[model samples]
Target: MTRMKELRKKKGFSQVRMQMLTGIDQSDYSKIETGKRNMSFEQCRRIALALETSMDYLAGLTDQDTPYPRTK
Candidate 1:
């Protein structure tokens, strides 16, 4: 499974829940998960936040799933 999908499942979130959390449509989220579509930077940021993971992890740049501390 893609890192995004895996993280989503690990968080116990469905695509519909993802839409609610990320403002991404379920169909489009599905495509993104399946690698049939690409997500914008904003979308990626939202997904990472919703999934409580780092964008670097989602991009396979790092194996660490823990997100970095956020600042205001």
Candidate 2:
């Protein structure tokens, strides 16, 4: 699954709700989540902000996906 879908689920955000929060259309958001559409860096950043996740995590560049790192 794409990071979008994973993060959305983790945040308990539905497609419509996420779209509303991100000012993106539901269909477009769905496409982005499915990787059927290419999202811009700004769009990804917005999603990361909305999901309370880091851009690196959203882009799968790192395993530390959570917005806030867990304190040991």
Candidate 3:
């Protein structure tokens, strides 16, 4: 699975559900998850927020799922 699918599944959200939350159409969401489509910055931010994850994670820049890590 691609990063998009992984993130969405980690949040237990279906493609339709995620699309609804992010205001993206279901078809578009499917394409994104399958890597057939690219997401805009705004869309990426909305998806990250909707999934309670960080943009960095979605973009494969980080392995941490959360937006912020707990201080040790």
Model 2 poorest 10 in a row by lDDT: 63-72
- Across 4-65, the per-residue lDDT of candidate 1 in tens digits comes to 98888878989999999999999999999999998888998999999998889888899999
Superposition error at 2 for model 2 (Å): 2.2
Cα error, candidate 1, residue 52 (Å):
0.5
List clashing residue pairs in candidate 1. Answer: none
Best model number under TM-score? 1
Q: TM-score of the candidate numbered 1? A: 0.94
Query: What tens-digit string does per-residue lDDT give for candidate 2 at 5-72?
Result: 87788779999999888888999888888888888888887888898888888777888877866367
> In lDDT terms, which candidate is top?
1
Estimate TM-scores for all models. 0.94, 0.84, 0.84
lDDT of each: 0.91, 0.83, 0.83
The C-alpha RMSD of each candidate to the native structure, in angstroms, is 1.0, 3.9, 3.5
Rank the models by TM-score, top first.
Answer: 1, 2, 3
Single out the weakest 10-residue window by summed lDDT for candidate 3. Answer: 1-10
Which residue pairs clash within candidate 3? none
Off by over 4 Å in 1: none
Deviating ranges (above 4 Å) for candidate 3: 69-72
lDDT of 3 by residue, 18-62 (tens): 878999999998888888898999999898888777888988899
